[model samples]
Target: MSKNSSTATGTSVSSRILLDAVTKHYPGQSKPAVDGITLEIPAGKIVMLVGPSGCGKTTTLKMINRLIEPTEGRITLGDEDVTNIDGDQLRRRMGYVIQAGGLFPHMTVAANIAIVPKMLGWSKEKIKNRVDELLELVSLEPAMYRDRYPRELSGGQQQRVGVARALAADPPVLLMDEPFGAVDPITRQRLQDELLRIQEEVQKTIVFVTHDFDEAVKLGDWIVVFSEGAHIVQYDTPERILNEPASSFVEDFIGAGAGLKQLTLNRVRDVELAEAVTGSPGEMAQDVLARVKEAGDGHAVILDENRRPLSWPSRRQLSRLETIPATPDAAIPLVTQGSTLSDALDTMLVSSAGAALVTDRRRSFVGVITVEVVMEAITRSRKASAMANDNDSPVGTNTGTIEVQGGTT
Candidate 1:
C-alpha cells in the first residue's frame, strides 16, 4: 500500500460515489438484503443513511469499500469502477470506523494511529508527523496521549483516537457506523461537534450509518432515508426532509417533534446572546456586586486573566466574599458559537442559572444564551419555513444528481 498518485500532493481529493442498481442477496434469504438502489453521494459532504433496525443500511455502507461484496450491480468511486477490485486494497484507500473505537488494546495511541501509514510504507518521520497532526485534528494533544495505551484513556478519548486512526492516511472518503453510539450523551455531543469542525477543514466524502435521526440531522449535509430492504424512501437535505416528507412512512420516522428538531438545523451564532455583568479574579467583590445591582442583573460572571469564564455567582454569594475566588464551581455549562440551539437548551436545563455560557473557539466567554432566546429562534424558524413552503421554494441544496429505481422517492 504505497502512496498513490491521488495522495501525492498531501491532500485528500474527495471523490463522488455512485451506486448503480446495487443489490446484495444472501445464499438462503428469499429477498436481497439490499434491493436495487442507486444513489449519488457528492464529494466533500456528509451523507447519512438512516433506517429502522435490521434495515440494510450497514450492508450498503460495507459494499462501498467492498467489505460486503454486492451480489449484483456496480459501484463506482469517482470515475473508477470499484465493484470488482480487491477488497483489502480497496479498503486501504478508505477510512472505516465502528462502534466503541474498535481499537486494539495492546497498542498505544501513537501505534494505533500509525497502522495505516506504516502499512503504506511511509517513512518513520512522516508517520510520526501524520499521527501528531491527526491527534490535534481530533482535539487530543499528541504530546500527552501519544504514549498512552487504549485502556488508559477515557471512552471519549478512545473514540477521538479511533477517528484519528481512520484519518491517518488522509483518505478521500470516510465510513462511520454508529461511531458515537457507545459514549455518554455529553461526550457524544462533543464528538459530533469535533467531527463537524474536522469536516470543515478536511472536506472528506463521508458516508455514515446511524439509527438515530437526530444525530443524522445534526451532522448530515444530505440524508438518505432507508426502508427495510435498503430502499431509498427519500434523499434530500435535513431541512427538506423535515418540512416536506415524501410519504407517511417518512413522516412517522420524523415523529411528532419535527418542529423541535428544527432547532438542530440552526446554530447558536444565528441568535443574539444576552450580556452578563463581568468581573475579574482578585477584584473587589463589593465592586462586582454594585455593578450587578446597577445593571439589574441577578448574577455576575467572573473571568480569569485571559477572559475565560471562571464562575458565575449571584449578588448574595458575591457579598459574602472579599474577592472572587480563582477557582469557583467547576461545572459551567459552556457551548461554542457553532453549537445548535438544541444543544444550548440542553446545557441551560442542566445549569443552575437556566442559561448556557457561550464561548469562542479559544474557550473565551462571549455571552449567555437563555431559554427565551432559543424559543424566539424556534418561532422565527417556523414562520420562515412556512413561508418557504407556501411559496413552493426548494428547501435544501442539491449537491449531486440522484437516480432512484423501484424506491419510494
Candidate 2:
C-alpha cells in the first residue's frame, strides 16, 4: 500500500499538525478570540484543547482546518503549509466530528458513512466494504444499523454513526468538537471507552475539544489547558499537570478532587495486591477456616472448579458453620487487572463490602484489595507528589513528545 493510503480495516498512517503563533481575530471584536497560540499536536495521539467557554478552544480547532481562518502565524500539517492548501481538499483529507453527529435527517446510517467515500469516487464495492468496516469499528452491528436512518437509533448509537461517518475515508487526522457531550452521563462514558478502543485500532491523530477537565484528562495523551484568547496555560501529560500545576489558575482549574482524579490514571495493576485465602467448593468448613486463619484475615474467597470467584460467606454464617455453605452468595464484586483504582473503589462502594476481588483477563482468581489498602496507596501517592513538588524535575517529563513548558495562557 502507498504511504498516503490506509488499510481497509486498521490504523492509518498519521502526521503531526503544528501551529506557530496562530491567532484568530473576529472583525468587530476588540481583542483577538485566539491570540499568539503556538502548539504542536503530536501524531497518533489524542491532543485535547480544553478550557472554559469563550476561551477560544473551538476557534483554535477551527483554524486547523481553515473553517475559521487564522489572522496571524501559520498552520502546518506534516511538512505542508495549511495556508497554501485548498480548503475543500484539506478538509476532505481530515475527518471532522461535531456535537450530536450532525447527520442528515434523510440519510441512512450507511449513506451517512458512505458520503465521503462516494465523494472520493470509490467504487460501490469499496464503499460498501468501508461502511461495514466502520460500523463494526464503533461497536455497532453492521447488518442491523446499515440500512437504518439516524432517527431510528439511540442518541449514543447516533453518535457512533457520526464517528463512523467521520472515519469513512480513513483520514489520518480526526477533529472532534464535543462529540460525546450531548449524551447522558452513562452513555457519555460508554462513548469515551469506545473512542479509546477505536483509537487503539485506528491510531488517528485526534484533536478533541472540550470544556470538561475530567474528560480532557481521561482522553488526552497530552492536554493543552486554554485560557481566554486561546492562551495556553499548561501543555503536558496528565500526570505532570496533576502533580505540578504551572500556575494558580491551573491548580484552580484542576479543582478540589485533583488527587482522586489522578488515581484514575493509575490502574489496579499499579498496586501490590493482597493474597486472599481461597477454597474449592467441596472443601470442608474446618479446612476453609484453617486456611483463612493462616492468612491472618477472617475472610475467604470461594472459587469454583474453573478458579472463578464464587462468594464471600458472611461472618455470622462462618462463625457457626459446621460445613461450607453449598449455596453461598457470590456477592463479592469482581474487577480485572486493567481496571483503574477509581473503578475498584466504585465497585467496593456499590457492593458495600470494602473490598474488591481482582481477576486476570481470563477471569481467573488473582487477589483482593481492601479499603485500608486503597487508603494506604492514596497516602503514599500524595507523599510522592509532595516530594516531587519540593524537588526539581519529575520522572517521565523531560524527553517525551509532550513536554510541560512554562508559559501563560
Best by TM-score: 1
Model 2 pairs whose backbones collide: none
- Please write out the lDDT profile of model 2 over residues 14-131, one tens digit for every residue: 4788787787888999999987777777788898888889999999899999999999888888778989999988998899999999999899999999998898999999999999
- Per-candidate clashes come to 0, 0
lDDT of each: 0.84, 0.79
Estimate the TM-score for candidate 1: 0.89
Residue pairs in clash, model 1: none
Cα RMSD (angstroms) for every candidate in the order listed: 5.4, 7.6
Evaluate residue 346 in candidate 2 and report its C-alpha lDDT on the 0 to 100 scale: 72
lDDT of 1 by residue, 307-326 (tens): 89889888899989998889
RMSD (CA, Å), candidate 1 to true, equals: 5.4
The per-residue C-alpha lDDT of model 1 at residue 326 equals 90
Error of 2 at 208 (Å): 0.8
Worst 10 residues of 2 by lDDT: 1-10
